[model samples]
Target chain A: MSLINSTATEALDLLAKGQITSVALTSAYLQRIADTDDQIGAFLRVDADAALARAAQIDQRRQAKQPLGKLAGLPVAVKDVLCDSQTQTTCGSQMLASYRPPYDATVVARLKSADAVLLGRTNMDEFAMGGSTENSAFQLTRNPWDLNRTPGGSSGGAAACVAAGMTPLSIGSDTGGSIRQPAGLCGVVGLKPTYGRVSRYGLVAFASSLDQVGPLAANTTDAALLLEAIAGHDTQDATSLDAPVPRFSAEIDRPLTGLRIGVVREHFTTGLDGEIEHAVRRALDVYQSQGATIKEISLPHSKYAVATYYVIAPSEASSNLARYDGVHYGHRTDRAELLDELATEQKELESAGDREALKNIDNGLVRMYRRSRAEGFGPEVKRRIMLGAYALSAGYYDAYYLKGLKVRRLIRQDFDAAFQQVDLIAGPVTAQAAFKLGEMAGDPLAMYLVDLYTVSANLAGLPGISLPCGFTQSGLPIGLQLQAPPLAEDTLLRGARMYEQATEWHKKKVPI
Target chain B: MAITRADVEKVALLARLQLTDGELKMMTTDLSQIVTYVDLLAEVDTEGVEPMAHAVEVSNVFAEDEVRPSLPREQALANAPGRNERGYLVPPVLGG
Candidate 1:
């Protein structure tokens, strides 16, 4: 296979055998990115010189027969939301367009410790707020399968880079299907590990409770390899799980004995694209042939996932985003003169002993805060902040934010009940395949529905994987999602691997 | 409940976002549709359910009070938009 198209596992084998050097592998990926990223828009920045230097160092270490990390000599792309210290992490928003972190995200640090060459940072929705990646303030990441169509977002660039053969592995974050949705739309493997499975120390927070970091790869095995390397406890992230990290790559090939997969009846309801449902059912049939049994199950409260998510995520986002006040860091408006004028007026009022008038005067600092945010963020981000502020505001907190949390509990209960009878729940990753770039523009409600089937996993803090199942009539890829109980990524990867081994769906290549 | 321009303005102030007249109009319509859609949550019976704050059950994750080297002041303030030698510069908070 060409170096650009080789899976991370295959490339590692070649590198270990001394047949291929990390320099060669990294160069091939960088070249491919340079050639295609202009059209695909998968990356915000590519660190070519630094990547080459790192690869050369890895090659030197291997020549000396030194100890190496699991992902040594492999190239990996990370979403721009991750802080790398070496590159600017923008989160695809103007708010941080020029802001550079002084530290690396836990995942980035992990990837580096694994000896994986950092290829570059990929584009994403501003603060991961939107699904289509159209909310990216910098560039539009188009689906590699079809240029005019969107690569499902906010991990759109992460998935597209892998699908377009720019990189063998990429790291993406999932707040609500950001990884899986785009991976499905791009015909690559994407995994959203359980909520606390990966640390989130330097990841730019959108929704603190729902966000997670995971891998996107060409196959389940690569995803497993990347997951094993990054999944562990970090003192920097208090929510990081202290449990033992399993050897996912080693256990991925083990076939389950009498695997019981649950198909949620609510998932196949109206609004799901017929072709996606058909493809998922066909995947279930493939599993049955492998001695796995499919059983009908119910997650009755899943219907409220989108509703609950919009409220809860935004409420958390509103609170989390309050830090970008232009005082500490990030974009600050140039309104010093305005402050000076306000200061002069206040001094005059104070000298006149007009204490009441001084109290009523507009605070220049508050106006600067408003103007800075308005100038910094994109429309979708502004809208979510507005909605979240409204929901969490004094009078509506109980009605909106608290009520959404209560429903979130019910959603988790539904998953807990269903998992009692089944090891994994299988369903379509999205209602439809990749849509036209502008298809859902100007309509945020329709865009929110794209996450209907996938949000429940994040809500319940379960591990979910999206792998290629089939394709639409127009040739866009369809994804089959398998969700496991919290911290059951071992089972999740094995289940995805079983389906992958039995079928040729994952082997399909993008036309790009 | 339908969101009005007044509600959008109020929320915008709370969020510290200055919206133009055009944005206020658009946000009023968009938020109304989204709020109505998310209102579907009210149909579900969540009586007696405790509000879930976090996915996993975790509490009081305290760390040892050990002194460690912190980020250098220069590195910490490297990304500041407006800063002096010691701290960030912002608009006047207490007027004069």
Candidate 2:
């Protein structure tokens, strides 16, 4: 296999036997990124000098017979949402365009401890707010399969880089369908670990209750390896599960006998493209041929997933994003004249000892907060903030945000009941293959509908994986999503692997 | 409830975002449509259901009150757009 196309697992084997050096592997990927990233727009920044330097250090450690971590010498790309002090962590927004975190996110710290070569930061939706990477304030990441279509987002850059062979593995965050949707569209493997399975410390907060970090790779084994390396409890993230981390890569190949896969009756009824439904059915047939039974399950409350997610995610975002008021470490608008006027007024009020009057006057600080955010955030971000504020506002809280939460309980109940009969749930990751770049640009609601089948997993806090099942007639790849009960990542990966082994979809390379 | 231009303006102010006239118009239309779409949730029978604030059941993750090393003042101030020798500089808050 070409060095650029080798999976992380394959490259690791070569490094272990001394047949190849980390420098050679890292350089190949760096070179590939330099050549193709201009067209794909998958990466926001590539630190060639830093990556080469790290690769050399790992090579020397190996030569001296020093012990290495699980992902020693492999190159990994991280979504810009994860903080790394060495580079600017722009969460694809101008609000954080120049913000460099003082410390590494727990996941980035873990990757460093594993001795993985940090290649670069990939692009994402601004604050992970949009379904497509087009919301990125910096650049638009195009699908490698067809440049005219979207790569699926907000982890579009992470999925695109892996699919386009720029990196063997990349880390992505999922709030709703950010990771799985893009991976499905790009014809790669993407896993969204159960909520709390991975720590969210250092991850730029989007929707705190739903955000999760996971891996995107060329195959399930690579995804498993990356997950194993990053999964564990951390003191920094209160939501991080205290349970022991499972060796997912080691257990991935174990065959799952008498697997009961549930197919939701509602997932196929409306807005689903015929080609995607057919492809997912064939994937189910592959499992059936392997002696697995497909059972029809009803998650009746799933129809409300998109509606519930829109309300709940935005409400949390409105509260979490209040900290970026330009007072600390993000974009601050320039209002020199207003500040000067306010300063003069404050001096006069303090000298006169008019404390009550001083407290009532307009300070310009509130105006600064408003203008700075207005200048920093994009249209979709602004819309969501407005929606969220309105939902959580005084009179409307119960009608919107509270109602959404109650419905969320119903959605979880639907999944809990389904899991009683089936070990896993299978469906299409997206309603259709990748859409054209501007197809849903003017319509935010239409764009949200794309996440219809995938949001239920995030809402229910379940582990979901998107595998390359087949392709559309236009050659756009289709993803078959398998969701397991919370913390059942082992079963999720093995189930995905079974279908992967039976089909040749994963072997198909991007035309880029 | 329909989202009028006034509603959008009020929400934007509450969210600390200053939108232009064109943005306000666009947001009014868009938010109205979104609110209408989500109104379907009102039809779901959720009586006696408790509101789920989080996906997982976790609460009061307490840690010992021992002091640990924290970021140096300089490092913390490094990304501040406007900072003085001691701390961040911002527009006057009280009267100034």
Candidate 3:
């Protein structure tokens, strides 16, 4: 085993004991990333300079006898979607390729204040659009467990990095299973907190009502610790909760007795692969052994989660993305002149134009705007953006957006009813293990279907988590999802901690 | 009915994205397939059921009326691809 392949908790203990200096640990991971990331493509941009400087600052603080934050000096990878002022914050697209945020995102600033070394920015689906990192415009982040398979996305890179030991902890966003799906495929723990638990001010918009930032780590406790650091309220984000952040790690090891884990009858039906189902069933057995009761419950609207998510997410995305028309912060050029057929576009550009205008302008800018966004964004992003625009258009708004909102209410109602009978929901995190990179490429519906089991939590605005339940027949990892009602991450985490304590899946690492 | 090539092209233009003929053909086929797949929702009998917008029943997620600090002008302008005396520099806004 590589000495560097340690859990976040172990790494912190080492840091506190002075067994490894922050600089040394950061450099070791940076060097490891340098050696392996070319093959894995986990990092979009590795900021060696900032990482080392942050480490040195932490070391200086240690020598000065300053009180260190619990996660101080640990190197954690930031997903490119979140803003990091000192680093190039590209949301894996050329639109924001040169776009720099004037200030760090709330989470990044929090990490900086805690003296954590921001290791680098990990790759993700452009605008967090797809289920595979394949949607990344820059590069594909492969599953480290099986290099040819996808790590799952849009947090694929974060999960891949943690699984491969490139970093002990990484943060990823989940509007609809972006964090948990990747974590499941990569054999790590990913948590999607209740909506508004984490601030979204610095995150590039995808689906505002659904988007949340969370962490991916090797184990449940590490995932909880990372969440504790970033899971508080900020006045800047209206959606941020004003509630106190829970002590996630403190109760992780708490007993699972008396916890009722409901196995969703809909989650393990004809569509789910047998291997993944068996894995989850095995995980359920562990909970039963731990004095937890398992009950079969039905979530009637569960079947509609993905369809509801697609419509609702696209509708929200259509509106939120209206600001990026080669105007405020993204791509720009001189496409002032327009053909008669393009008069509508001309009017739009004129109305929304920022002061970057020169006296003479050609169709070059409109062309560039079209081309850059076309070439810069991946297929999934384009699909959603188009779908969104159509849905939000005046003609289709009621049919699509409004209709989707009502269905969303039903979806949430389904979860509320289920939670009435059970303390929490548990099932396989995904229908299957990680597949080869090209396995589902070019099939957008298939990609969306992968989130069938996970999207309901987002629709319900409930907190959910995916932890390593088992490996598939092909030896790829599978995830088992545990969900709780709003503010019930403690129960979900506790149940996961108990199962993890009984299993060895969390201890397995990729050969890389 | 299947989504036509013209539909795809029109949607692309609305998104301010340019698609080549080759891509148009590909997307036409892909979108038709996706639309057909999503047509599964049509069978769900959603007449009286309201379409869901947000999962939670949150009505208004409003930031308080407070004048918090904005990022400094220079810092905000730091990443602008082009800039002039007043602000971000670009081409003419109107035609003669």
Candidate 4:
């Protein structure tokens, strides 16, 4: 097999045996990226020289028989949402187009500590605001399976890079299925660990409460490996769980006898495409025949997950995004231009003898802020900020934002009650397989509704995984979603691994 | 409730964003459709339910209140679109 087709685990085994050097592996990926990135658009930036240097250092350590980190020499791509000291962390937005953070996010730090080569930064939706990477301010990343279709997003580039073999492993932040949605579309394994399971210290905030950093990889085992390397407590993030990190890969091969798999009845309702439902049901059969108990379950309040998430996420976003004015950092307008405009306004007011209007003109700072934000954000971002501002406005607070919060509680309650009956919940990751580009364009609501099956896990702070289940007649991959109770990713991984072994879906290569 | 052009204008002002007349019209329609869809939450009976802010049950996570090394001034200000000796430069808040 070609070097690019090897999974991270397989490559690591070769490196340990001295059969392959880190420099060779990293160079192969860099060369492939140069050759194919224009067609895939998976990468926003690739620092080839830095990557090779890091890989050579790892090789030197190995050749000298010195102690090495767990992921020594592995190349890993990171979503643009995370802060990296070596690259501009744009969060895939024009607002921070030239912005580079001085400090790396905790996850990036951990990747370096593990001796992994920093592959490069990948593209994403502007601030993770949309499901499709089409919301990216840079280039749109196409699904590796079909260039005419989208790689589901805001972590679209993260998943596409893995699917396209540009990188063996990539880390992405999932705020309402950004990681898993794109992973599913691109036919790879994506895991969204329980909220607080992974530190959110360096992640660009979208919906603070729902965001989590997790892994996207070629298979379940590699996904678990990447997750273990990054998951842990950090003092920098207050929400970071203080619990000891579990050896996630240690449990992947364990047999899951008598595991209770709850099939969410609500997930199979109207609008779920027939092929996806069929594939998910077939996956349930694989579990049932393997000594697992399949029970029908219902999360009644999940009907409101999309509605609740929309209101709550945007309300938080409006507040979180307020830091970007033409002041401390990010894009700013020229002061001279603002001053000239201010002079014109003041002269006009003086000629009209309207002294009161001059007081507002004195606040040219506000004018600069307004112009900078208006020019900086894209249409989707501005829409969310407006929605958030309206929802949090004094009179509407109780009706929209507050009510959304209360509904969120009910959604959590629904999950808590269901977990008591089953160990894991199984369902379709998305309503359908990857759709053609521009299929849902012009209607943001249509795009928002596609998140219905995946958002509940995020709303309730549960860990969920999306793995390839089967393919459509047109060769599009379908995903089966398995969600576990809080911090039960080990259980989720074991179940997904069993399905992966019994089926050939994950073995099929992306046509790219 | 249906959002109007006036509501979009008000929200835009509150968000400190200066939307053009064309954008304002488009946003008025878009927000109206989105708000109407999200209005489905009103159908749920959440009476007396406590509002959930964070998904996990976490309280004030405090660290020792001690001074720590911070980012150097240059690195912190590296990404500023406009900066100067004092700090980030901005338009005058006071009339000359």
Candidate 5:
């Protein structure tokens, strides 16, 4: 079997047994990426030299009879949203196009410590704003299953890399279903760890309160392995919880006897694609057959998740993104300089009865800030920033932001109540499988609706996982989503493993 | 409530974004549609529900008041689009 096809766990075993060297394994993925990435567009950047160096270092460690890290030679792709000092981290935006951080994200640092080969930065929705990676300013990541369709996003490229067999694992940040939705569409295992489970130190902030970086892997075992490596508290991130990290791989084989799987009634309601709903229901049956009980539960306020998320996420995004003015960092507008020159002309023009010439020139610090941001951010980003600014603006905060907060409480309470009766909730990851590229591009709201099932997990800060369960008639992959109450990743992964083991769905590869 | 073109322009200004007239018109429609959808939240009676800021209830997370290593000046300024010996250079503050 090709090294790319082996799971990270199996590959690590092979590396340890001297059956395969890290250099050889890394070279295979590098070659695969070079050969296939043109069609897939899964990566924003690939550093062949650095990747080989890291792999050679791992092989040297093994040859010297030294202890190796858990992921000694595995090639892992990282979403561009995560910072890596070794490569440029663009967050898929033109604003950060030439920008490179001096430090690696905590997750990236952890992956390196585990001796994993850093494949490259994967494409994402710019600053992880949109559902489809078409929002990416760089390139569209095609679903490996069907080259015409989206890979689902903002972690589209990460999931596509795994689905295309470029890498066995990739890391992605989930903010309103970015990771899981893409994972579902790409037919891979994507886990969004509980909020605060992973450090967000070097993750470019999208919706700070909602974003959590996690693993996207070819299989549940590899997903769990990757999650274990990155999940922990760090002093750098204030929200990162000090909660004890579980050995997720060790708990993967846990039997699902009497596990109460809650099938959320709300998720089965209107707008879910028929094939996806059927596959998820069938997945529930598999769990039922394996001694797990499926119960109908309700997250009554979950209907408000998308709306609440729209208000909350963008509101936070507006505030979080405010730091990107030209003076501090990111793209600076030459318009500011031109405007300054124009202001001088404006004074003379105004005196000469040509006030119209001064319309676009506001030559001050305020002008620099506005002009830089205007040039830097994309349309969707600007739309979100405007929506957030309006929502949090003076007259609307109480009606919009505050009301969204109240509904957020209700959403969390609903999940809290449901967890009392069930260990985990199961549903479809998205309303449909990967949609055709540009399908929902004209309608931003339609794209937001695609995240209906997955956003509730982020709304309530719950851990969620999307595992490939079945496919549509058109052969597009459908994902079954499993969510657990906050900090209940152990239960969430255990439940997903039960379904993953009972079916060979995960073993089915995209014909990339 | 339908977001008007003026409303979008106003929000755009507040967001430090400069939108063209065409973008403003499009944004008006888009924001109106989004607002119409999110307006659904008003239907759910959130009576007595407290506002939630975050998923997990975290009090002020205080690090020890000790100085630690921070990013070196060059590393911190590496991604700056405009910089000089002092720091990131900005447009004139006074327009003088």
Candidate 6:
């Protein structure tokens, strides 16, 4: 009977029937966010006035008998990586602290078109780097389920907001389990659509090849609803898939009677915490009870997914983030006098940087390129960038980048071969439940291992969804991931919906 | 277990980032720990096991050699910390 905790579908039904106004609904969510956000750190920015204004428009249209989109004023939080025209979209970095984009990301534009109220941007690991939100330069978004524990990141804030009931859904970008891992730890549902399934045109890049935008919501249906609204061809993104967006929600009731679920052998390794494994097993029972067949399959190459992901992700990130030098965008120090005087500028920039990078920057007339790059990027971001530059660096491209490419092909082949024999792949979303905050900070590799179970999907270009299947005795939620072949998002959703309906894990709310 | 001061400087230069001696000393330890942890990869025999690059097999991505609209010069230039009349501004490097 609670209005705030109701699913998006239920909320939409109420709005369509005039049982509630978008203004009222948005206000209610805002009130909840205001009460809980200080404790949860879910939002990096909240524009109460903007949210209400948008909601008022939706209410007005509905009263006038005009058409309404499916969401129709639902409030959804967006990750900081996505652009928000009215808010400064700093991706947890001091460099972009004061910058605001003039245009909304494609997903944001779609949400606006659907009449969804934009709640505000949420916190994330700086440039979506760390597994725990601890890497955020601004704030650490505490896990809603257990504040003492981490909200698995870099979509940490978005996931925490939904789990804390700040919003029914939120948009998050996943490069490597950024959406799903947090969704699992926070006890929410997160969907990582196939790469290119959702447009990445406006997403601030972390790793170009691996980066993707997806939705994190309270339940499978809500997640599906958001996906339906965001998925489609985006002319602005060259690599975006041109396929028609599927009716994700419509498949909620799709029969799973003949589902052939593949239990990935590698997911059951000894490194997995016992209770998490149990939860996955329990969730698997849902399919078995529904007359679906379960088969154990080997993705032997999967053992190396994390290793492959780190190298490739950082390498790509190194390249993609190369644009954020102190010169062109986001963060600069004053002392720059040469920009006005051509001769002075030429003298300064020419000697300032590497010849190759200098070509990209204008220093007086001579132009300096790499020097600005030298100043803008952070150490963690820079380390990866350098690795990428070196990978794509002369003389090493074939040995490093090309070798990585070959391995990527092999990884995809493993998934391709596995998908042919199974309707879907099932496993824990992470190696174990969320670890203590700062536990992995000193060991970046340990943090990356948190993504071992989830990164394979990114490496293979497949759709994966993570839902709270069970909980550890310590009370941490465990995610059961369901992955399907490329463009098989519906299968993953359908499988997840079935499991969700069969369990009460989704109903367990965080006492925010 | 320890990254030398020289190691930190080398990495900093490679990354095109600056670090003070004090920061360098701290990073030497921190970076060394991280490097050691990631060295777990060394345990696995990846011989002939090609390194995976992506989850999907997408190759030769192409764009029509066509010009399209881009963000305005003003918006693109909005985030820069240093800029002057013509373009972005930077610290002096002529001494180099």
Give the higher-DockQ candidate: 1 or 6: 1
How high is the CA lDDT of each candidate model? 0.92, 0.92, 0.82, 0.90, 0.88, 0.79
Q: Show pairs that collide, candidate 1.
A: none
Q: Can you give the lDDT of residue A189 in candidate 1?
A: 98
Writing each residue's lDDT as its tens digit, candidate 1 over A51-154 gives: 99999999999999999999999999999999988889899999999888899999999999999999999999999988889999999999999999999999
- Classified by CAPRI criteria, candidate 5 counts as medium
lDDT of 3 at A108: 88
Interface RMSD of each: 1.7, 1.8, 3.4, 1.3, 1.5, 5.5
**Docking outcome class, model 2:** medium
Q: After superposing candidate 5, which stretches have Cα over 4 Å from the reference? A: A335-337, A344-361
> Measured with DockQ on alpha carbons, how good is candidate 4?
0.80
> What's the ranking of the predictions by TM-score, best on top?
4, 5, 1, 2, 3, 6
Highest TM-score: which candidate?
4
Model 2 residue A325 CA deviation (Å) reads 0.4
Q: Among these predicted structures, which one has the highest DockQ?
A: 4
Per-residue C-alpha lDDT of model 2 across residues A241-266, encoded as one tens digit per residue: 99898899999998799999999999
Superposed model 2: Cα runs more than 4 Å off = A337-362, B94-96
DockQ, cand. 5 = 0.75
**What lDDT, from 0 to 1, does candidate 2 have?**
0.92
Error of 1 at A400 (Å): 0.7
Off by over 4 Å in 1: A336-361
lDDT per residue for candidate 3 within A422-497, as digits (tens), equals 8889998788788788888877888889998888888888999999988877789999888999878888788789
The ten-residue window of minimal lDDT in model 4 chain A covers A355-364
Instruction: Report the candidate with higher TM-score, 4 versus 6.
Output: 4
* Backbone clashes under 3 angstroms, per model: 0, 2, 20, 0, 0, 18
iRMS of candidate 6, one decimal?
Answer: 5.5
